[model samples]
Each structure stands twice: as structure tokens, then as C-alpha cells.
Target chain A: MSLDKADVVKIAHLARIAIDEEMIPEYTNNLSGILELVEQMNAVDTDAVAPMAHPLDMVQRLREDQVSEENQRDKFQEISPKVENGLFLVPQVIE
Target chain B: MEWETVIGLEIHAQLATKSKIFSGASTAYGAEPNTQACAVDLGLPGVLPVLNKEAVAMAVKFGVAIDAEIGKRSVFARKNYFYPDLPKGYQISQFELPIVGLGHLDIELEDGSTKTVGVTRAHLEEDAGKSLHGEFQGMTGIDLNRAGTPLLEIVSEPDMRSAKEAVAYMRKIHSIVTYLGICDGNMQEGSFRCDANVSIRPKGQEEYGTRAELKNINSFRFVEKAINIEVERQIDVLESGGKVVQETRLYDADKDETRSMRSKEEANDYRYFPDPDLLPVEIEDGFIEAARAALPELPDQKKQRYIADFGLPSYDAGVLTADRETALFFEQVVEKSGADAKLCANWVQGELSAALNKDGLEIAQSPVNAEMMSGMMQRMADNTISGKIAKQVFQAMWAGEGDADAVIEAKGLKQITDSGAIETIIDDILANNAAQVEQYRGGNEKVFGFFVGQVMKASQGKANPQQVNELLKSKLQA
Candidate 1:
């Protein structure tokens, strides 16, 4: 139920977060404590109950399939860092 | 060692919806870049995703078409990954609880046998945008217009034993989805795409070999070729004292080879968790029933009906029903022409298919519409034009000449059905081919075909073939 230093490092890497090597212990402790709380919550047997997905007892609101949005490309791209030929450009991510 | 190939397909069928899956932005393809991307699709802060009712209904219809168990309490989860195409760091997808489950599709095999492929699940997810790699200098151009498009990712079990079986399975899925009107099933525009997991095991081995997930295979031919090449590569690796590495590979159809997608190797973990922004979608029985009621007759059902009702051969039924549009065109021809269904099936599968393929047009985009096709079929059915001459009339119709009657009149290609005119042509053919007549009377019955051919030729291929046969037989005997 607890995360080790390597686990925290891998988690940080997967999350694309930059964490200092010296701060790994502190982050691991914090993350492990959160996991322990989850463990304590998981200890109670609730097999008969359905898994809750949201805090509020409500289903997802459904929207009708209609095109309500207009052409806001110029307005939206005005805030982007880089754009060319009506495209958002980023570092090469060829895969 | 006899190696047996195992293939399982993961098909991503873009649902035919007007708007995005979770946003109101338009999902139309080929729009101006980023024009259809709204704040929600752009993943702006504080923007929540609302489920599209049509998307859910489409998914439900797909499930019902496949006889799948619709997930009443389906939940969306976050598939965490990092890519520029995915504006959000994580994709909202259904993980532990998918929308559809445990369906099966029976694919017709090469030998006229059927194999039921097990569909593991079909989950709804949003597609990532296109990453134009070489367009920008040291950067990728991203079009977020496709970022939030809804996709039904259908996963199949490793039930296919060959590349042909895999293609058959993909085609069956494509047919069913298009028939349900859930997906357009256009592989070229990437409305329908497939990723195959291919591996090989010994013939008698119960355990499977390590599989390589082949990505970027768009067309059915590429799917089959990719699986076959990947299987060969795996077998090569095994026989050369090396083990096959289980990884995602890219199928370069242009090169006809698969290469390792090394960039994705390190970051393969898609840490999935329940997405809290969206709540559980509780599909009730009433909703499922409505979707089921809205379901069109599926491809398999139509194929079976074509066989049972029309007495079409299994192959013809399969070909005619493989595409919903083609099947609709065939049925319309049958109804309009009042001809035999088998005859309509033949024209649809033979000449119509050839013309459509030659022009690289879909049945919907055919130059000759159903009415025109049925008109020609009616001519052939009512003996107004010989079948051979019908082909000529069809070419004329395809060339924008006119309807069957107009083309027949313009070309003077009406069948020589009048007894007097046909007998004149037959008498001339019989007189000119005195040698052939003697040969036929001398019991060399094969020359009867030559006599019939000569008669038809004299009639400019307009002689009714049955009448030609009868008159020629009686004349030669006398």
C-alpha cells in the first residue's frame, strides 16, 4: 500500500513532472501516506456495494449532438505559443 | 516446426456523429484546422465534458447489433499519457467497465466455412489529433479538430488463425458497424482504422508466442500483409535463437515491412484511473431498447435473408451484403426491375461492382444510380435486350447516353425476339455456313454453338439466345 522511492520516481517520470533527486524521499513519504489512507479505506469490506464514481449521486449529463461551436480558431490560437498555417506546432513527437 | 499464426484486431471505428464525443464542437472531417476545436475540446481549464447522447446511442446500437451486453453502469476512466495531439494529458476512455462486452461475430472463411470471432469488448474513446511530423521544422503541426472525435474501439480475441481470417474479421466488423449506421467505415479517411496483435505458436502448442502489436495499418490489405510479415519476422526471430520482443511495431505499407516504433517503447504504460470529471453513465433498459429498435438489419442478418429468401448462393449473398450500400442497391434493383433476386444479385455483384471498382467509386457515388441499373435489368428480364447486348446498353448508360430504352433505341440494340426477323437471320447464317450446317447434321453437335454464334453475329448480337438454340436445332434436323 506504500510507495517506495523508485515507485515515486517512476510515477513522476510517467506524469512528466520534474522532481529533484533529493526530494524523492519526502515525495515518497507523502505519496505513501496518501496510499496508506487509501489502504485504510479499502480495509472495510464493501463487496455488496457498487463502486462509486462521483461524489454527488448523479449520472452524467447528456448533451444533444449538435454543432454549437463556431470558428474560434483565430481567437483560440491568439493565446497559443506557436501556430503556423492554422496548426498548433509543438516539439516533434514522431512515433 | 509448423507455426500457426494468431491475430487479434483492435479496430477504431469513428462514430458518425455530428459533434465531438464530449463537446459541442463539430466533428466533421476535413474542416479547417482548429476551427472545430472549442474550449472543451482544447482542454481549457474549468471546462467539463458532457457525454453526447447520440454517441451513447450509437454505441448502444453497435452493441445491440453485435448482440453484446450493454454496460448499464459504464464508467469513463482517464488513460494517462503525454502527446501533443492529446491536448489533455490523459484521454477519457472506458477502462475497467467498457460500454459493450462479450459479443461474437461470425466471419465467412475462404472455404465457405464460418468462424465465430469473439469480441472481447468495444469501448468508446476520443481520438487524438493528427500529428503532421515533417510539416514543421523540428516541430510537429497538430490539428486539434480531430482531438475529441468519438471512436468505438472494438477489441477482438486472438481467434484468427491466418491473415485471411484477420482480414475477414476486420471486414465483418466493418460491415456490421456500417450496417448499424454507427460508423461510416471509411478506411481511407481513417474513419475506420485497425491495429493488429500478431504472433505465432507451434501447431500443437497451446501457449501463444509473444505478440507484436502492429500499428498504423489502415486498409484491409495492409492488415493482412502486416500480419503475415510480422508472423514471418517472429518466426525468423525464434528460429534464429532469439526471442520475439513484445512491443508495438509500425507497419510501413509503402515499404511492405514492419519496424519497431522505438520511441513508444519506453513510455508504454498507460496508467488508467477513473475519470472524476465525468460521472458514471447509467444506461437503462429503456435506452438500450430504443437503440435496439433503431438498429437497421445488420450484415449477417441481411446475408442470411439473401440466402433464404432470394436463394442466392452463399458467396453471392456474402458479397452483396458485405457493404450496406451495395446491399441496398441490390434490393432496390430487385424491387424496381421485378426481376429474380438472384439476377439482381448478379448484376449488383458483377457488373455494378466492376464499374464501381474501376471508377474507384462507392455504390453511393456510382455514375449509374439504382434506377438506371434496374432499368437495364428490366430490359434483360423482359427479353427486350439480350444479356450480351445488355452489357453494351449498360456501357452506354454508364457513358451518359440514356436510359435502357433510349440506349436501346439509339444503338438499335433491341433483341431479335420477332420470329420472322430471327428466322431470316437464322436462315442466312444457315445458308452461309453450309459447312457448319453439314457438320452439325453429321452429329458434330459442338458446331451448333458455332451456328448459334453465327446467327447472333448476323443479328448483331441481338438474337434471343434461347430462340436461336431452338430454331437452329429444328432447322439442322430438317
Candidate 2:
């Protein structure tokens, strides 16, 4: 349950957040602590116990096949602050 | 120099549930920035979250579709994080016990090789709101309409060895989501997103090399590109005797390069424990059976049936079965028009696909449907409309729906198949192209094309080419 300090630095760089050297030790400690808990989970002997995956076991839910929806144009565009008429307004994209 | 690329994918698909995964607010897209959000989504004091039933159903639906085990009991865990977009300061997700277990899906490689990709597991989680960067002074604007929306994190096994296989697997996943009606399957809409884990090792190496995970690759093409570039980068690093570091990266589509976003960290420290608020979700066998029964025909099975039943080629079956709507449309066209299934596949792939892209419309919005297309194709087969005039009729059919007969009648686009009309046109073409006609008589029979061209021009391209060619040959010989 230990992550190297350098691994913490690499993770921060990959996540694109600038973290100073001071935060690296803290992150490393925290990450290792979490992995410790995860390793504890592995100790439980339950090879016979099936892995529970999804919560729902229903076979199927069928909806009456019908084409019944309108293309909500005005309603969809109403939320955008940058709307020109019916289209989402974006900054001038072309010269 | 023999090496192989190993690729796996982590896909986070926004579920089709009406409400947010844990909140009562509507989980709709394209909504007003902060309006649809409830107090819980806003993270107000003491607002607890309740999981949406639809989301559970959707998760079960996917499990059933893939023939994966439905966890009769599952629990949601809290993933602690601090970000401006995550108002709750933690997302509710499944970590220890996922909702769906391991399953295998088969995909066909481009070179006609088949391989089965392994699905690691699928877990359900709630989404965080978006942070709008680059809006003003680099200050982020938070949009909560998407907050608390349900997402299923599907992790795949590192079974793919090439960029093409990776994409094919992703496409298969996309088809499953769409076919299950569990997601809109819109990659551009941020509804379905992919994070690829890529590594490269020597051709015969058993132990895998350190893998780099790339995030925010939204499109399938970008996923393939990112994987290929990452593969090359890893190869270069190993060749130079430098160790590859495990980190998260972003694919800059403009630069066509991947840059390290951060080092990969095991987030287990989020103190992931089952949320105390929600009880362990218990799914009975009856519930699982119902979800299983609702599974639609998956893409691979549908593709195989199109081959065995419809006599479509493997490639044709692949293209048609890429999407559920496209497959259904092709089948309906084949049924209603009673046209050859092969022709139906061709017309749908050729003309229907072109029109759908040009107009930026979904298959549901197309003016010409499967039946109308089949009708038009059948008419062409019967010589009621030459293939040339069929285009004109097709253009009309796209703008407005009328069968081949009505569209042809309104647009006056019937094929000139009558022998009398064709003969007259052929005679005129022979008179007009006397030089070419004389050449044909003088043993330059290859010049016969000159008469066919003139006949087409005289008949305004409505002349049946086969009929015109035969009539012209006889008249010229006589």
C-alpha cells in the first residue's frame, strides 16, 4: 500500500493540474492509504460467492414501438445565451 | 522490430434515464444553464440524493444485452473529489461491487479477422456538472443541468492489438448502447465518451509494458488516432532505453498529438465506502429475467442474420448493422418493396447515407423512408425509371415523401423505356452523330458509344441505356 512520491508527481502532470512538490508527499500518502483499504478488501475469502455486477435482473422492458416525438427546435435552443434565431450562437467561426 | 500494441478502453456513457442518477432534477441536455437543477444538485444544505429507477433499469438492460451477470445485490460508493464542477464534493459511483460483470463481445477486424474483446465490468455513477473554461478571464462557469446525470463506466479488457481493433471494439460498444436504448450514442454530444489505455510490447513478450491512459478523446476517429500515436511514442521510448511512465494524457486533435495531462494516480484514497444513504440494491431473479427479455437483437447477431437470411455480403451486413436505425430501415425496405436484399443494402449504404449526412438529419427525420426507397428501387428494376431518372426522383423523395410513381409523376421523371420513343431518339442520335455513325460502319465499332451518348442527350437522360444501345446497334448495322 505504497505509491512513490514521483508517481504522485506524474499523476498530477497527467491530470493537468499544477501541483507543487509540497503537495506530492501529501497525495502520495493519501493514495497509499486508499490502496491499503482496497487491499483489505482482497483479504475477504469469498471465492464461492458470486461477484455481484448489475443491480437489476429484469429481462426486458418493452416500449410500444411508435414514432411520436416532435423535433423540439425552439425549446432546445432557448437555453443558449448565444442563439441567433433558432441556432446556437457561436463566435464568428470564419473570416 | 516486431512489436504489438495492446489497447483497452474505459467508456463513460451518460445514461438515458430521465432524471439525474441521484437527484430529482431533470437530467436533460441543452437546458438553461442552471434552471433544471434541484437543490440537491446545487448541493444545498441537507439535500440527500435518491437514485433514479430508470438508471438502474438501463444498467440492467446493458447487462442483459451482453449476457453478463446481473448483480443481485449492488451498492453505490462515494468517490471523494474537490472540483468546482463537482458541487457535491464527491460523486456517487460503484467501485467495489459494479453493476455488471465480465462479458465477451466479438468484433470483426477490417482485414476480415475476427476476435473477441473482453468486457471487464460496468459500474454506475453520477455525473458532475461541467465547468465552462475559456469563457471569461479563465474563470469557469458551472452548469448543473448535467450534474447528477447517471453514467455507466464500462471498462474493457486489453484484448485489442491494433488501432483498428480498438475502434472496432468501441464501435461494437456503441452499437450495444444504442440498440439497448440505454444511451443516445451521440459521441459529439458528450453523452458517450471514451478513455483509451494503450501499451506496446515486443512481439513475443508475455509481460505487458507500462500503459498510458488517454482521456477526452470524444470521437472514434480520434480514439484510433490517439492510440496509434501513443503506440509509436511508447515504441520510441522503449527503443531509446527510457521507461514509459503511467499517466493520463489528452489528445490534441488540432496538433494530432497527445500530451501528458497528469500522472496516473490510484484514486482509492477517495475513501470509497458504500454510501450510507442508499441501501444495497437488491435485484430479484424476476427483475433480471424481465430485463433480459427486453434485449434487442445485438449488432453482431443482426449482422450474421443479414448474411444468412438476406444473402448480404459480410461488408454490406457490417455497414447496415453499424446502427440500429440503419439496420431496421434496410430490413423494412427489403420487406416492403420486396426488392433484393442486396440491392436494398446497396441503396441504403449509397444514397440514403449520403442524404443523411448532407442534410444533417437522423434516419427518423428523413423525408424518404425505407419503404419509399425500396419502392423507387423496385421501379428502377422494372424499367419504370432508368437509374439516371431515379436520381431526380430520389431528390424529390428526399424533399417530400411520395412513392416512385407519385414523385415521378409530379416531377415528370419516368424512364423512356418505350421502344417507339427509344427508336425515335436513337434515329435522331444516329443522324446527329453521322461522323461517329459512319466510323462505326467502317469497323470502328467502338464509336458506338457516341450514338448512346447522343441518344441520352436527346432523351434528356431518361433513355434506358441498355435499350438505347441495342436499338442503335441494330439501326446502325441495317
Candidate 3:
């Protein structure tokens, strides 16, 4: 139930969170304490109950398939950091 | 030592809906980049997603067509990943519970045998945007126009052992989705795309070998080629005393090779969890029943009906009913022309198919539609035009020269079925070719074909072939 320093480092890498090398031990301890609380909750067996997708017991609302939005490229792009030719430009990402 | 190749396909079929799956943004393609992207699709703050009912209905219809179990309560999960195309840093997809589950499709193999490919599951997911890689000042340009589009990701089990079978299976799925009117099935437009998982093992082995997923195969031909190359690569790896590493590989269609996608491989660990913003979607029995009732005749049913009712050969039936548009066009020709079903099948499978393939046009985009095609067929059936002359009329009709009657009249290509006219042409031919006529009387029955050809040629290929044969026989023997 407890996470080690290596585990914290890997988790931070996966989550795309940047942490200092010296901060790894402190973060690991904090994360392990949170896991301990989760372990206590998991100990309460509820095998008969089904897994829930949401906390609220409500169904999702459905929308009709209609095009009501107009072209707002200028309005939306006003807030972007970098845009060219109506495209949002980001650092080069190749896959 | 023999090796067996195991191939499976994961197809992403964009559902034919007017708007985005969870937003009201227009899902039209080829728009100005970012023009159609709204707040919800851009993942702006304080925005919530509502499911599109049409997409749900379409998915249900697909499940019904495949005779699959439709999940009564499906949950949407967040697939966390980092990509420029994906704006929200995660994609809303189905994790454990998908929309359609445990379906199977029967694909016709090269040997005319049918094999049932198991469809593991089909889940609904939102598509990511496009990242234009080059010529963006050394930066990638993101277009969110494609984001939030609904895609039904259909996964097939590793049941195929060859590339041909895999293509057949992919084609069958394409036909079914298009038949259901759920997906457009346009590969060029990226509406319908496929990724393949390929592995190889020793013959008679129960355990599957390590699989490498092939991505970016956009065409059916490429699908077959990529899988074959990947399988060969795996065999080479194993034969050389090396183990194949499981990774994602890009299919370089230009070089006809697959190279490991190093970056995408490290990002494979997708931590999936249910999206708290969306609750479970519970389907009612009434909705399922409605989808079933509204289901049109699928390809298999239509093919069988063509065999039983129309007396068409199974091969002809299969070719005619390959896709929904082609099947509808064939039926329209039959209904409008009132010609024999066998003849209708021939024209549809022969000239119509050839012209469409030549021009790279779909049946729906044919210049000579069902009405004109059937008109031409009618003329042929009623002996108003000889089969030879009908081809000329068909060509003219295809060139926008008008329908059957108009083209026949315009080009003076009508059949000269009048016995008097045919007899005159035959007399002229017999008189001009006395040497051949003498040879005909000298027991050279093969010379008879020469006389018939001469008569038809004299009549400008307008003489009815059967009439020419009978009249030539009486004259030459006399």
C-alpha cells in the first residue's frame, strides 16, 4: 500500500509533474500516507456491490444531433498563445 | 519449421452524425482549421459534455446488425495521454464496459469459404485532432476540427492467420457499418481507418507470440501488405535467435517496411478511469427494439435473397451486394427495367462496375444512374437494340447524351429487326462475297460465320444477331 521513492519518481514522470531530485523522498512519504488512507477504505469489503462510474446515481443527459454552433475561430483564437493560419501552433510533436 | 501468422484488426469508424459526440460543434470535414471547434470541443473551463442520442442509436443499430450484446449501461472513461492533437490531455473512451460486446462477422475467404471472425468489443470514443507536422515554423499545427468526433473503435480477436483473411474481415466490417448507415466508410477522408496487431508462432502452438501493433495503414491494400511484411519481420526475428519486442510500428507504405515507433511505445501505459463528469448511460429495452426494427436488410440477407428470389449465381450476388450503394443501385435497375434478374445482374456486374472502377466513381456518383442504366437494359430486353448497339448507347449515355431512347435515336443505333430490311442486307452480302458463298455451299460450315459477320457489318451492326443467323442460313443453303 505504501509507495517508495522510485515509485514516486515514476509516477511523477507518468503524470508529467516536474519535481526536484531532493523532493522525491518527501513526495513519496506524502503519497504513501494517502495510499494508506485508500487501503483502509479498500479493506471494507463490498464485493456484492457493483463498481460505480460516478458518485451521483444519475443517468447522462442526451443531446440531439444538431449543428447550432457558428464559426468562432477569431473569438476563440484570441486567447491562444500562438496561432497561425487559423491553427494552434505548439512545440513540435512527432509520433 | 513452419510458422503461423496471427493477425487482428482494430478499426476506427467515425459515426455519421451531424455534430460532435458530446458537443454541438459541427463535425463537417475540410473546414477552416479551428473554425468549427467550440468551447466544449476545445476543453474550455466549466464545460460539460452531453452524449449525442443519434450516435447512441447508430451504435445500437450496428450491434443489432452484428447480433451482438448491447451494453445496457456503458461508462465512459478518461484515457490519460499527452499528445498535441489531444487538447484535453485525455480522451473520453470506454474502458471496461463498451457499447457492443462479443460479436462475430463471417468473412468470405479467397477459396470461397466463409470464416467467422470474432469481434471482441466495440467502444465509442472521441477522436483526437490533427497535428500537421511540417512547414509550421518548426512547430506542429493543431486542428481541433476533428476533435470530439464520435468514433466506434471495433476490435477483432486474433483469429486470422493470413493477410488476405485480415483484409476480408476488415472489408466485412466496412460493409456492415455502411449498410447500417452508421459510418460513412470512407477511407480516404479518414472516416474509416484500421490498425493491425500482428504476431507469429510455430505451427500447432496454442500460445500467441508477442504482437507488434501496426499503425497508419489507410487503405485496404496497405492493410494486407503491412501485415504480411510485419509477419515476415517477426519470423525473421525469431529465426535469428532473437525475441520480438512488443511495440508500436509505423507502416511506411512508400518503402513497404515497418519501423518501430519509439516515442509512441513509451506512452502506451494509459491509466484509464471513469470520467466523473459523465454518468453511466443506461439504455432501455424500447430503444434497442426500435433500432432492431429500423434495421435495413444487411449484406448477407440481401445476398441470400438475390440467390433465392432472383436466381442469381452466388458469385454474381456477392459482387452486386458488396456495398449498400451498389446493392441499392442494382435493385433499382431490376425494378425499373423489369428485365430478367440474370441479365440485370450481368449488366451491373459487368459494364456498370467497369465504368465505375475506371472513373473512380461510386455507384452513387455514376453519371449514368439507375434510371438511365435500366432504360438501356430495357431496350436490350425488348429487342429494340441489339446487344452490340446497346454498348454504343451506353457509352453515349455515360457521356451525358441522354437516356436509352434518346441515345439510340441520336446515334441511329436502333436494331434493324425488320425481316425485310435484314433480308436485303443479307442478299447484298451474299452477292458481294460469291467466293465465300461458294465455299459455304462446298460444305465449309465455318464459312457461315463469315456470311453472318458480313451481313451484320453491312447493316452497320444494327441487324439482330439471331435474325441475321436464320436469314443467312436459308440464303446460303439456297
Candidate 4:
């Protein structure tokens, strides 16, 4: 399925990123090319082929049901770009 | 307009592995940032991921847990995505051949109705790093600490009809993951997360409606709210003769609404091809057999056994087996106390759960342990403590840091079941309450309770209530 410019605009808006209008045509063109490639797989006689989920067959491996460690917020916060009173600082995006 | 809510989910859970999936980096959380990310994770050029044996073992373990078809051989593919967190140019995931196949999970709703949700697949993948947006005026902060963490992506079919069922399905998944020790099931730390795909169609329509995918539902509450809002939004659009747009949306928990981030493009085809760097994983019969043997009793089987073997009601068994730790604790109590199984289940479900809830703690951090609880229950059975006193003893035992008998002795909380001593106290009470005693003698039978109360008070509220009642009734009749 070759999606047009309208499809690209809509998908970007749903995913919550502000996409520039100039980027729309390029994205649309690129996505259609991908869809075309996936179409090649469709030509295979896969009607009887079961959909594959994972790569291996295995069973249960259990832990000793113990909590071994705690998160180091102090250490993690040290790497944050902006920290105020042990809390991460972010730009005000909402009114 | 007639409509039906269609929902599916993609659950990402961190596997319980001592080492990271692709690299041998310690899977241990809370370490200093940049410490755990190895050369492979840091994307030092030419650094390749050496698959962790534990990670593969866990993947197979989960495959067996879900009763899914496991392929003898599985392959990994490269999913190309450019982001700060995904240090590798592409994330190596099981695109074509995954280890676990289709499975079904049965969920029980609060209304006592059961629904079956189909698990489309469970696959292995590496985690991306955390990107902190809005950290600066003109830039975003990137934390590469979480990069390359092993994740098990559990995809569910569009079998759920309502938000209630979606939540139910998530809870069942959560229980299984936690029970099997595959995932910590912590939403806050994002050890576990769910992405919801929701759409609405005519109630009986065979063709599917356009769907929207929402990410960042880190908690169950968020999942339910995000799906509900999205479902309503889709329904409203359809009813107004407007076409529902197919796109990806992010749930803004603060606003409790989903606004279009961007229109969704049909870009699922990432040109997935087999990853050549790593070898295909081949599991043998012995491997599957070992995994099966290691499988501790699953929740469903344990629930059934709890009901049949312990003579517990269905609800009680469900509550006890909801988490593995609680069930294990109950078992230990039963083993030590050798008390009635039903009563042991009661203490675990009733008193133990109450305390755990009050403190917002899991069973591992609970002040009460199984053996101690069993000792306390024994005290109750032996009449060493009354029901009312048992609660007091329980609290004392919880805070006192000792066994039930020790706490009882230290607090001097033993029940007064001495018949001769109780008779003396009862006689003294009768002498003092002469007017009430005379009335009781003249056939005001209820006055007997007042005398019994006096005897209990004389015994400092520890008098055997049943014995006091019997003695008071007989003495009053005389």
C-alpha cells in the first residue's frame, strides 16, 4: 500500500511530534518505498505459514524471589542536566 | 451510531537476568550511570553483543510459562532507529524469528466473569535509553544508562472489547510476570510498561476500524485512563460521520486526554532482515525439560490446589496466590503452625494483607513472617490468647521483633482461663452489684451479662469469654 502525503501528516500528528511541512513529502516518499519492499514478502506462499513470535523454545527460569538492590536516585540525579532539590528540571511546555 | 471498542497492547518487561541481554553488563539497576553500559552498550565502534546465557534461559522460561510454541531455532533482526538512547544504529530484536509463539491468557474480572485474551507473541529485544525532554532551554538531556537493557515484548491480540478487560488483561500479565520472577512488574521504574492500541467500530462490524496507538502508559491506572479517553474520542469521531484517523498518540496523564502528536504512517515495515552478527539460538529437549522442572507451581495451579488441598474458598485462594511471596509466606506458616489451613489463609489474606496495604509494602518487607504468624495462630487455638487479644498480640508481635510466645510473655497478655480464679472474681462482682444480682435472681436474665463483664474486668480483660459466659449463666440461674 502506497500511502500519500496525507497519511504521513496524520501519523506524525498522532505520534505527538511537530513535523515540518517540508519533511512531509520526504517522509511520505520514504515510507511508500518501505511498503513496496515489504510487499515482496507477500509474494511468498505464506498462507499456511504460522506467524513466528520468538527465536527459541525454552521454559521457566526462576529467581530466588529476593530483592537484591535499591535504585540510587542520588547517583542517577547527579547525571541529570538540571537538578533542583533532588528533582529533575524540565522546560515549561504546558500552560 | 453503533460502535465497539477494540484494544490491543504491547507490554515491555525487563527480564530478570543478572546480566544484560546482549552484553554481559550487569542487569543490576540503581548502579551509577555509564557504569553498567559496557563498550557494546556505549557503542564503541566494532563492539558486538555477546548474548547472555541467562537472558536466553529466561526467554525460554517465559515461553514455557505462556504455553506458547517454542521454535527449536530462532533468529534476531536489526530494527534500525536513530535516537540518543538507542546507541546502536539499530536495535537487535527478534523481527522474523522469535523464541516464543502464540499463547492465551485467561483473566478473571472483578465481577467474577472470566475472559480469555490472546497473546500474539512474546519476543526478545534490547531497551533504549531514557531521553529527558525539556531539561534545558534549547536542548534535551539524554541518559544512556538504560541503553541496551534486555526487554521481553509481549504483544496481545485485539481480543479485548472494553477498558475494563484491558486492565484485567494487564493485571493477569503482571501477576504471571511477577510470579515467574521474569519481571519486577514495577511501573514507576518502568521495569514494566504497556502501549495500548485502541479503536472503535460498529458493534457487529467484521472489518476493523482505524486504530490509534498510545505509548508511555507506565502504570495500570494510566493504561486504563488512556484507553478509555482514546476509545471515547474515536467513538465521538465516528458518530459524527468523521473518519477515525490511524496514527500514534501519547497519553498526557496530566491532561487526561490524547491529542494528536502526528498522523500515523504505515511504516511498520522496517525492512527487517536476519542479524548476521549473532548466531541463531537453538534450544534442545533437555533445555526445555530443565526449564519445565524449574517452573515453580504457577498461579492458576497453585490457586486450584489452595482451594482443594487447603479447603479454602475460591476468593481466598485467589487472594493468597495473587503474588508468589504471599503464597510462600502462607505455606511457611502452615508448615510451622500445623494449624487449620483455612485459618492460616485467613490471617494471610485478612491481617497480613491489611498490614501490607497500610504500610504500602510488599510481603518481603512485611513485619510479620510465616513462622511467627503460625506461632501466634497456635496461641489463639490453644486459648492462650482470645480473638480480641490475639489482634493485640499480633500487633505487639509485629512491633516487638520476636516470636508469638515471646511477645505474649513480654507483654503479659496471656488469657486468664483459671476457673477457680474466675469464680472468685465473679462472686466478688455479684456481691458488689447486689441490686443487679437480686434482679437476676428474680429472673432478669440479661443481668447475667453485666456480672460477666465485671468478672472480665477483674481479670484485666483476659478472662476466657466462653468460660465467663457459661459460669455467669449458671451462677445467675442459681
lDDT of each: 0.90, 0.80, 0.91, 0.79
- CA lDDT for candidate 3: 0.91
Ordered by lDDT, highest first, the candidates read 3, 1, 2, 4
Task: Write the residue-wise lDDT of candidate 2 on B1-478 in tens digits.
Answer: 7888999999999998777777656666797676666667767678776667778889999988877888877778888766666766678889777889888788998789789888989999988876665553424466667778889999999999999998998899999999989999888789999999999888999999899999898999999999999988888898998999988888999999999875224443475766766667767898889888877888988999999999899999999998999999988888888878887788889888999999898898888977788889889878888777888888888878477889888777778879999998777777777788778889997887767777898888888888887888789999
Better of 2 and 4 by lDDT: 2
Model 4, B1-478: lDDT tens digits are: 6678899989998987776676656667766555566667666678666676666777778878888877677777888654556666678899767888898888878787778888988888889876666656654455555777889999999999888899888878888888888888888888999988998878888988899999889888888899999988887887787898878788999999998766233455455767766767778889988997898788888999998999888888888887788889999998888888988888888888888888888899888777789899899889998877888788876775588898889878899888887888888888788999888888888877778777877887888999899888777777
**Chain B TM-score, structure 4:** 0.90
lDDT of 3 by residue, B1-478 (tens): 7999999999999999999999999998899899989998999899999999999999899998888999999999999988888888899999999989989989888788899999999999999999898967679999999999999999999999999999999888999999988999999999999999999999999999999999998999999999989998998899999999989999999999999987623857789999998999999999999999999999999999999999998888888888889889989999999999998888888888898899999888999999998999899999999878888888888888999999898888889989999998888888888898888789889988888877887888999999989888888777
In the range A1-95, model 1's lDDT, one tens digit per residue, is 78888898788888889999999999999999998999998999999998777788988889999988898999999999999999999988763
lDDT of 4 at A47: 84
Q: Order candidates by TM-score, high to low.
A: 3, 1, 2, 4
The better-scoring model by lDDT among 2 and 3 is 3
Native contacts retained per candidate? Answer: 0.91, 0.00, 0.91, 0.00
Worst 10 residues of 2 chain B by lDDT: B262-271
Q: Which candidate has the highest TM-score of all?
A: 3
Candidate 1 lDDT over B197-248, as tens digits, reads 9999989899988999999889989998999899889999999999998888
Measured over all alpha carbons after superposition, the RMSD of each candidate to the real structure, in angstroms, is 1.9, 7.3, 1.5, 6.2
Error of 4 at B180 (Å): 2.4
Task: Kindly report which residue stretches of model 1 are placed more than 4 angstroms away from their true locations once superposed.
Answer: A1-5, A39-44
